[model samples]
Each structure stands twice: as C-alpha cells, then as structure tokens.
Target: MASRRRSLATYAVATLVLPLALAACGQGGDEVDVDVTGTAPATPAGSSPASPSAGGSSGPGAPPSGRTELPTSKRPTVVGTVVTGLEAPWGLDFLPDGDAIVTERDTTRVLRVTADGEVTELGTIDAAAPEGEAGLLGVAVSPGFADDGLVYLYVSTAEDNRVVRAELRGDRLGATEDVLTGIPNGFIHDGGRMVFGPDGHLYVSTGETGEPERAQDREDLGGKILRITTDGDPAPGNPFDSPVWSWGHRNVQGLAFDGEGRLWASEFGDSTWDELNLIEAGANYGWPEVEGRDEGTIEGGPSGDYVDPQAQWRTDEASPSGLAYADGHLYLAALRGERLWRVPVGPDGAGEPEEFLVGDHGRMRTVAFAPDGRLWLTTSNRDGRGTPAEGDDRILVLKP
Candidate 1:
C-alpha cells in the first residue's frame, strides 16, 4: 500500500502549547506535565471526518459530559533510536528515572533499556507460552515503584492469560506473584495491553479469543476492559460489580488516557472497519453485531444498542494496535496500515486524522510517550506478519 503524509499547519506557541505530559499511566508521583510547543497539521484532503456526535452523549455508552479541548502541538519527528535488533518488542513503560522496561512477545524476554539506548536483559518470563499472538505482552512499573520496587507483567500461559508482578532487584527479577488470572486465551486475540489510570488502578484490555459470543457474556472475562487494584482486587466503582469496566469488544489492542483522563481504545475490525472508540463505563461496543458506524451496511452499526466509534478506517488502511495520547492528540500505531495516525481531539469531538511516518517503519506495534517528551515506537515485522527490514524489529524515538 502506498503511504501518505498530511501537511501540517503552524499554530502560535501561546495558544497551541498546553500542559501535556508523557503517555504512560505508570509514572507514579513523578508524572511530569510539560508543554510540547509546536504546530499541528490539518487533516489531509479526501480524509474522512470523525463522527459528528463525538462529544455528545447518545445514551449509555456515549462520551461523558464536561469534556474540553486539549492543547495541540506540532507533528512528531524521529530524533534517534533507543535500541535495535529486538525480536517483537511489545510492552513499553518508563521508570521514574527515565529508563524503560520492555517486553518481548515471542522470546519472553524482559529488558531494561537506558535513556541513552543501552539494552540489558533483565530476565525471561519462563511461564509464558509463546504461540501466535500470545506471550509476554504488556509490562508496567508499579505506581509506587520508588517505594515498592514492583513491576507488573501481562503474560499468556498454557492454562490462561494472566498478569503477574515481581520485584525489580537491580539486574534480575524476583519471584513472580499472580496479580490477576483466568482471562480467556487463544492462538489469536489474546489482548495483552495494560496501563495504570490516574486513579492509580490498573486497566486491562482483553480480547474475546475469536469467540464472538464471549464478548456479550458478563461472566466471561474475555472481550472486556477490566479495572483492578494493584493487588488484583476489583476497583471500587466498577459498573458490573466485577472487574469489568466495559464489554462487547472485538480485539482491542490499544488503550490510552487523554488529558481529561477519559479512556480511549483502538479496536481491530472484521474485514470491514478499524475503530478508535471513546470508552465509557459499562458500555457495550457491539463487537459481533457492529463493526464501525451505524450506516446500515452489512454487519455494520447497531440500532442505538451500542456506542459508536469516534473515528474509523478501512481495515487495510488501519489495523491499529498501540495507542498513545500526547500533545493533545491520539497517536495510533497501525500494523497492516503501516503508519502512525495523529487524530486531533477536544471536548467537542474529534477532528480529521492525519497520517504520519507512513511505511517508513514496518508494522508499527507499540507507541509510547516517554517522560522526556519524545515518542517511542516499535516495529512488529518479526512477529510473522510483515516483511522484515534489516533490523526486522527496533525501538525508535520521535520528537512530537
């Protein structure tokens, strides 16, 4: 597929720059809010606009009220590479001191990379059974890492998909403890992205493991966004009285929190549309019932039975995976589309989305904003999906 880059528009520093920080929710108390001063691009011509009712509440699952516009910034540029020669790098989160903890999906290797691009293998997660899309996927440092020294991991085992944590004792990991368990696992669709919300609760995304019916089953752990404490207990105000915060999703891989702390997710569609959804508490996404908009297409939108996606794209254009919110925009890493999408958002709604770094890196996977005000992106060519470049898989740094 041919890639396209949108033309950017310059905005004044005083108006465009706002207090935004890195994308990680696991920064603990060291979360630094910085202004990424620059210009933002206009949506390229011929691009589709976002849903008209993006900020308005349609019903149960609509975006909540009291939303506001975020500070906009300039387009991101690649400054340097943090590391290279990585095999399917997946989860990425930074420690308080700015070093990153990275996870490898198939190799089950956990690594700590310094800010200057020095890579060190911390340990291997022996419990993960790597097959297909399942393995050691998401890694997060504890919100209280300075005091607790704990780091959490989301791994796929033979029995089930689970989250485990261990102490980061310098160069090695201590014994692991199960934080949460019993999520449905499969050769495909084992959703394994995790992030800590500003509320200090862990938010986990789970796929239905290719079973469409499992998405609607409340008792089933699959196809849901779960909120839990660090100890694995359900958070206090969960709508289902269980760990489930939202349900009825078809393979959600990307999760990020906007400046207003609203949760947003990127979902893979079934041969139709890929979605960028504004998630709400207890809302149903109409996985098997709906794919994108309520345009009455075949297997398209439901009749007010499910929430609509904020924006959508053709499947070939955007098999979106990792998502990050930085500088008042949502950055989506696309696999099949092979581009980074920058969608401008506000309390009113989403604007036209522009394409960035298109086809320059193959099969973008994880896109995280580092504490030092740059973007960290990983490639997934070695995951048996895309054509591998010389590096096959690498971690590149971008300035946004």
Candidate 2:
C-alpha cells in the first residue's frame, strides 16, 4: 500500500503546475462555456434562473425574505454564527465530547473548537503544501474514538500531501503518525479531504495534481477517490482491487451521504463548469475529456465511457466545496461562487438541484450537519476573495 502511494511523489512533482497552466475559469460569467465535448450539462427543461437578492451579488440566490428553504422545501432562517475568524477553513468534524476539530490551510494546523466559540490550537503537521490552493484540509473522527481517541487528518505538505493519524489528548492532538503519504501535491490540485464512511472504511478525495490529463488515467492516484482502512490499504471489493472508488475527477473537495446511503460529491471544473456528482463505486466521471454534462464521447476512461454529471453550473453560480445532507436534501458550500446551494433529493436519488443562498455570506466553505440535526456552515473570505465583513469568516447555524 505504501509503495503504491509512494509512486505518486514523482507525479506530484511533475504535474505541480496545472493551476497556472489551465485557463482561468468562470471569470465572472453567467453561462459555463462547455468544454471541448460540445454539450452543456443538462438541467430540467423548465429550470429558470434565480433572482438577485438585496445585496448587489446574485446567482442561484438566497430567499427574498432573508431566509432559506429547508431540505423539505420550507423556508430557512439564520441560526447565528458559531465561531468566527477562521483563516481558510475547509473541513470539520464534531468530537464525541461536545467539541469539534477544524482544519486551516495556511497554518497547517488543526484546531479544537469549544461550544462557546473558543478555538484552541491542537497541533501542526509537517505538510509541505504549496500556497494558493493547498494545505491542511480534512479531518475525521475515528470510528473507535472511545477506545483509541484517534482522529485522522488530510494535509497538503511541501514534501507531499497525505493523510495522518493523531491521538486526541483532551484539547491537543498527540503523536501524529503518517497513515497514507505521497498523494500528489501542487498549488491547486492537491485535494485534501477524507471521511469515515458508515462501513468503517476511510474514504479520501484527491485532485489531478495540476495535470488535467492525469484525471483520465486509471493507473494514477490523482483525480480519484480512494476507500481504505485505518492503515491505508484499499477497502475490500474495490474496482480491480485498486484503492479508488471513483475516478476522473478534476478536484473533489466536498462529499456527503444522503439518508438512503447515496454519496454526493462536489467538483471544481476548469474555465466553465462546476459540478455536483452522484457517486457510486467503480464509476467513472469525465474530467479533462469532458467538463460537465457536455454532449460527446469521453475517451481513455475506465471501460472507455463518458459519465454524465448530476448537476452543473457556471463557476460564478456554484464553485462547490464541502457538502452536507439534512432534511432530505444536500447543501453544498460554494467557494469562488460565494453561495450556499440546496438540492432537493427524492427517494430514488433523483432531484433538481437549485442554488438557494447567495450574498448572505461570502465564499462559503464547509456545511456540516450537527448531531442534533442542526445545519451548520462556514465561510472562507479570509483566504482572499470577497469583501470580508469585519470578521467574515464565521461558522453559521441554519435555523431548522
């Protein structure tokens, strides 16, 4: 397992220039310029654009009454910000003892946040991450926390971005150990997110390591999601016994599961489309070959197929980040898009996804479903994007 992961260090070094080489995406546009494949992502025929809000900003907009629609299609209200002043916060996990673990990109540190909004520095990793788009990113609570008090983190290190495990010691994380290393790193494509699925397996999302072409390669770890155990071996019954669950993604930063156990992923597209994907094991998603739901054949993929995107939008509308599901819907944080989007889900995994909140916050990052069923969100203006409203980086609770 280590050997396979180690193989990526070379690729990480070789393909580390993709973000600069790729064309600028979305550059303030309403329509996503379809990729070379030639077809735009399909939406319901009657789909109309959302209205602009009180603020100058607009897109898939926030509710007119200063509210949001619940997962049940009801209106939603603000529940107040939980924590504030997080610098480029990306992922979070609630602890067993009424606390939460948070990741910071620039600091390369994990923070433990208390209920009263106090944040204590946990510890730092030796992540050799590149600036502009990489650093400490994802955190996951151990399924055996009671016995081992372990927490897992995915980091973008300068040497290589990888996953590491640390023992949780009250407010500090102790004794960090590398679990999976050398997963391809770069300024933009070093994907840093991980989660423990219900099946007791660890799932990880990786980027194309700055190389768009790598996304289409099944033999490469870049642009793939992997399922592994605590020790970083591929989960059982993987396609071809590879650690990958799904492949051919540009950069997947957000992942969530609905009540029916369907996994949804959020992807960052180049120049045009931003994607929301319904994920299944052994599935292929078109990336470099196809950007969104474009009309054309995608070549050089597993089974040589072109997979369609579930939902897509111009990057101005939804450059989606972390994802969460509640009230029978999925809520995704839009980064470059600066909004929160709600997608209604049906019993059989089909539903129309529409943008719900825009301009309420700036550069939304992560959306989490708390244990008590409250919907929580975080903003990322501090990492540099929109106008930061004094202390704009905040964790907000959505009134259910």
Candidate 3:
C-alpha cells in the first residue's frame, strides 16, 4: 500500500513541473502525427489482444446504428496538434460550444479549454483532498447545459467522496451544491467517474475504498454503480430501490453506454486481471471472491451467482480508467499499459481489442469523443508511473 501510495503522490507532484516542461516544447499547440498501428508489447498471458473484426454489426439487444456510425477497417491517425500544459488532467466533458472542461486530479483545478487550444482556469474545488487517487476526478457538463449552464463533478473531500453540481458563472464555477454524498473514501480506492446516461439520469461509479468487503456488501455505497437524479435522489425504477444499481466491484473508474444502451465498466484488479465488464442491473461481479473469468478461485461469490467479465487483461497490460463509446467501438485508456485500446462491439459481444499509440504517449488516462468526430485522449505521464516527455500530460486529438 505504501508503494502504491507513493506512486499516486508522485504522479500528483510531478505535474507541478508540467507547465515548465511544456513551455520548452512550444507551449500551447504542437503537431505530431502518431502511428496508430495495433502493435504493442506482446499480450501477457490471460489477457486478449486487439483484433480486427466487422465494424457495423449490432450487438445483442442493440439498437440500429443510427448516429453511432463506426469507421470500417481504418486505423486512426493523430491529428498532428495536441493541447498541452495540463496537470494530471483526469476527466473531460465538452460544452455545447465545442469548448471542453478538464479536471486536474491532484490540484482540484478545473480548466476551460477552447477548441482552438486556449486554456483558462474555470475554478477549483476547495474541499478536494488529493491523496493517492483521491481528488477531483470526473466532470460532466449538464445535458441541459444550453439552458441551465450546470456542471457536475466527482470529488474526494476530507469526509467522503461526493458529487456536486455547480453553475458556470461567467468564467468561473459558481457556488457548488452536493448532489450525492456518503460514498466511502480512502487514499487509494475512491472510484470517481460520472456521466449522464442517455436515459437522462446520472450514473456514478465508486470504488470499494481498499476494503474488499464493501464490494459485496449490498448495503454499502462503495464498489457499486449508483443511479440517481440530478438532485441526488435515487433514480426512478432502480433495481435495489436505493442508489445502488450493481455491486461487487473493486475500483471502477470507467463507465460507458453503447448504442444499445448497454453499460460497460472497466475495473482494476488485485494483481491478476483487469476487467471490462458488461454490466447488468442487480448483477454481482465477483471482486474479492473472483479476479478474472473464474480461474477456479474459491474466493469469489458462489458459482452461478456472479457475472463474468466480457473482456479481461493482465493487470500489467491494462489498468483502465476513463471509457468512451464512439464509432461502434469502446476506447479504453490504459494507465499502466500506456496505450489506447479500441474494442469493437456489436450486438453479439466485444471483439478483440486493438492497442494504439503504444509508448508514443505515456499512460493515457481518458478517451472522449469530440463534437467534431475526433477522439481526445489525455496522458498521465506526469502522474508518477510514466517518464514525462517534453509536453507531459497533454491532450492528443486522434482522427478515426
């Protein structure tokens, strides 16, 4: 735990020098064409590697591919210029005007980045406590932002991990109000990812706070995906009649819904596996009791009682964080694997994942789609585990 703690702390402090390093590389915008070849280090045993598959097929129960059109058999290329000088940038959400709001995990600083690469400090979360992975993590622009101008954040406070909503008053965030509270918080496992589902409800992912038991405890708020309204009340028709939607997760930082409205989450594993699970309502994902797809371990929930991950990787290959669904694929940003993974999805299931930008940009954290049909990826090189480049912690724009 101490080593892990140090890693997280180092990542935070390393960002302090990011501005200086980025300035030497030409400050704001620098163009570099990235090779999107699906080649990285060989997949370690027990994890699936990326594969090419038919692109337009629909997954089971998936709706017709209307606006979710995917690129067919084409490799993505870097858009040449990157948005630089971010400090441990964690979450990204685009505004109606094509501007983006980015969160700095350690500093609790929220920045407004224009489509043209202009950066401005929007505001900071005063109560955010940065320890290990606990800090201001995720940000989401209100679905109704055109009218209400509200922004939501998932932050780690001194007392607990919570979600708060604020208004964008001019250039800074206005007074904040808590939307959800009482989620368990610790130095290491404060799961922090928030997104408004297509169903018009807010879905929050939480970690087990380094306490494995909480993952299985249906009564606990940690280690589960919670669904609620904008005002923090449980969403109507929740499976448990509480905020808890699904249970038995260790640390889930990535959440995305496909064209089919199926929820997929990325989970961090103990030492063996990292999982990309197809989440179902009220289903239990074996966490303390199971690691990956049942390696015959007795520690998981009883057989036939828990759900298995649709895809898994050795922890070394994928400690996935933020997730985005675009063009019929799920893009996962790997922290330890230091690459962008693209998994093709259809109504059947997930195809083999392909790795991109491997070792080109160190420790990718978040993958989000822009309004212009491009993929915006953030690096975590300044986040302790990676060797910082000239413009460390940059946002790379990729064209699919």
Candidate 4:
C-alpha cells in the first residue's frame, strides 16, 4: 500500500500542469481564466433557489421556501464534463453502473445523474428542514446496494439533525427508516456529513450547533466524530464504548480515509483558523479552549491532553467542506477560499497543501472520487455566501 501511494503521488504531480494548459487554450468558453488578485463581486444574501418539493409541501406544514433565481453562467473548463443544472448540489456518490447520486441542500432532492448527463429525480426528503446551513447534506450508497438497494442520507429536520435510510424502489425512493437521531440542531453549525468507513461502519461528523461547550462534552453527540454500525448502534471496539469516536471539534464537514485506512477530517473554525485533523480513537481536539494550536493552557483542560491539528489555515483562506483522498493526495474543497487544495500524503504524514484553481471556481464544495479515477467537484456559489457566475453551481470533473 505504501509503494502504491508513492506511485500515485508521482502520477498526480506529473499531470498537475494539464489544468493550466487547458485554461490558456479556452476550450469553447467552457473554462474561465480569471485573475486571482481581482476582487469578486459582493455576494447576495440567501442566493440559493428554493426547489419545489416532491411531497407537495416543502416541509412539515411549512410554506414553500422562497427561491432565489440567478442567471446561468458558462461552465468552467475541466478534464471532463459529466452533467449540468444541479441546484445547490452537495453530496455525490456513484453507483456501480457509473451513474451518480447527488443531494441538493435546500431542495431536499436526491437526483441521479447518469454517465451521459441525463438527470432523474429519485426522490425528495420530506423531513429536511432547509434553513441556514442545514438541510439534506450528505448521501452515500450502501455497500450492499446491489441487493438491498438502500441509500443513506444525513439531513437536518425541524427538531434535530439525524441520519436515515431509504430504499430505492425502481426510480423513486421507497419508505424511509430513521437510523440515528437526537443530534443538536441550530440555524448554523449543524455538522451533517457521513461516510461508511473502510471498516464498514458509518462515521458521522457533527457540529457544536453554535455552542462551543458541546464540543468538550463527551455525552453530547454534537461536535464529534461518531462511529456506528449500519443499524446506528455504536460500533464495537469504540474508545468510549459509545458513538463518540473523538471529541472537541467545531464543525467537521469533510471525512476521508487514506490508502492506509487512516481517517482525515476537515473542520471549520470560528474566526481565526480552519483545521485538518488526523482522527483517532478517544482523542480530544481542543476547540473552545484552543483554535489551531495550544499556545497556552486554558481552564478545565491541560495542553498536553489535547491533540493538535495536522494542518491549519486562516479562516478567511479556507472554510473547507468536503474532502477526498485520491492519487496519494487529499483534495479539500474550500468554500470561502474559492479554490481546490491538494495535500500530498506519504508514510511520514501530509505535506504542505498547495492551492489549485484559485478564484476560478466560486466557493468550491464537495470533492469525490469517481469510479473511473476522475475527481468530481461541486461549486457552492449559489449557497448565499458567494458571487454566483453564470451556471453558478456546477459539478466539474477533473483528471487528478
């Protein structure tokens, strides 16, 4: 595994220059070459469009959410173009047949975009409470999907944030089953990203819900990395004998495992710093007490008790969301930074992170590895915090 990771790193470095060349040639105006130093337009407040819900009403007895419409923009130049016309698309997972499933944050819609760019609405999540940063967030296909046809979703409901399982009945979604519940929910900081780990257990990242104290509370589910079985029970061999795998996280949105089965996570910091951590069992990451590193000890904790972050960036430069590990590198999607970052990994640890596509795509979000070895990235410009260009929110396929 170590040798393979090193080889993949070589391939990634050798082909890294292709994107610059493609940007210069301007392939049919599909890609843009923008000045990284230029100022971006002021972002409009609440710019995401309210997609029509499938269950007649948008939420439980609530009125249809207001939609914010913007003019479409030209698609950016990338190695591959799979599909277009995704509204606030967040999570992405590909099926065995090469078709991909995507989740729209505000719309609560789960769409299946085929390999040929044909999009079919699989279903809409009726329980999704679309507000601020909470809604239908992450989607993952079950490893047994070929037989059980179950797809998992992480969403925020009116009362709290939870995880549910929905069966795929033909083209539409079947009945829903609640797997986990009682995660703290708020207008902001509802950490909602889940992935099945290499161990076949579901790993969930939750936020402190604007309450920094919850990060240190081991009993609370908020602001921690949770490890559970598919049945939502705490997985065996857990450090705390509970779902809490690690505590003291602010808002973790990105989770990925390296080739060696080591877990890496991306977290959004308060105002000073954003962090990338190597998650471990029963570990405490200083949150309210420490932001990036422990400059000094604080009350209720000692500095040596907490583990420092593996990598950190200023909050203005990196509000990282989704993370993907491929070609011996971890690709982190930065929201406020408006760029994609590549961090090379080896047996020693992660090296310095390098920026890519700086200011080219607005508010990049999720990064996922497709089955065909291409890296799929989503734009979050239409999420109310970014200046949306034409075709503002799009999925760009890159060869990395």
Query: Best by lDDT, which number?
Result: 1
Model 1 / residue 346 / CA error / Å: 0.8
Better of 1 and 2 by lDDT: 1
Give per-residue CA lDDT, model 1, range 228-286, as digits (tens).
Answer: 99999999888779998878787788888878677788888777667777776777777
Worst 10 residues of 3 by lDDT: 15-24
Q: Model 3, which residues run further than 4 Å from truth?
A: 1-73, 295-304
lDDT of 2 at 358: 62
Kindly give the stretch of ten consecutive residues in candidate 4 with the minimal lDDT sum.
18-27
Candidate 4: which stretches are off by over 4 Å? Answer: 1-77, 295-299, 302-304
Number of the candidate with higher lDDT, 3 or 4: 3
Encode model 2's per-residue lDDT on 1-400: one tens digit a residue: 0000101111111111111111221111111121111112122222212322222111122222333333432434454566766666777988877677888776676888765567788887764353767777888999899899999988777777788899988777787889888688777766666777767888888888779777777788888887889988888767758778888788887877666666677888787677666675666676776676645443444455545655566666667778887768777777777666676665444355545456667777788877766667777776645556656566776643
**Model 1, residue 293: displacement in angstroms?**
1.2
What are the models' TM-scores?
A: 0.81, 0.80, 0.81, 0.80
Q: Write the per-residue lDDT of candidate 4 for residues 299-335, one digit (tens) a residue.
A: 5573236666666666655688888897688888878
What shift in Å separates residue 289 of candidate 4 from its native position after superposition? Answer: 0.9
**Model 3 scores what on Cα lDDT?**
0.70
All candidates: CA RMSD (Å): 11.7, 11.7, 12.2, 14.2
| Per-residue lDDT of model 3, residues 118-199, tens digit only | 7788889998988777888999899999999999999899999999999998798998899999999987777888888877
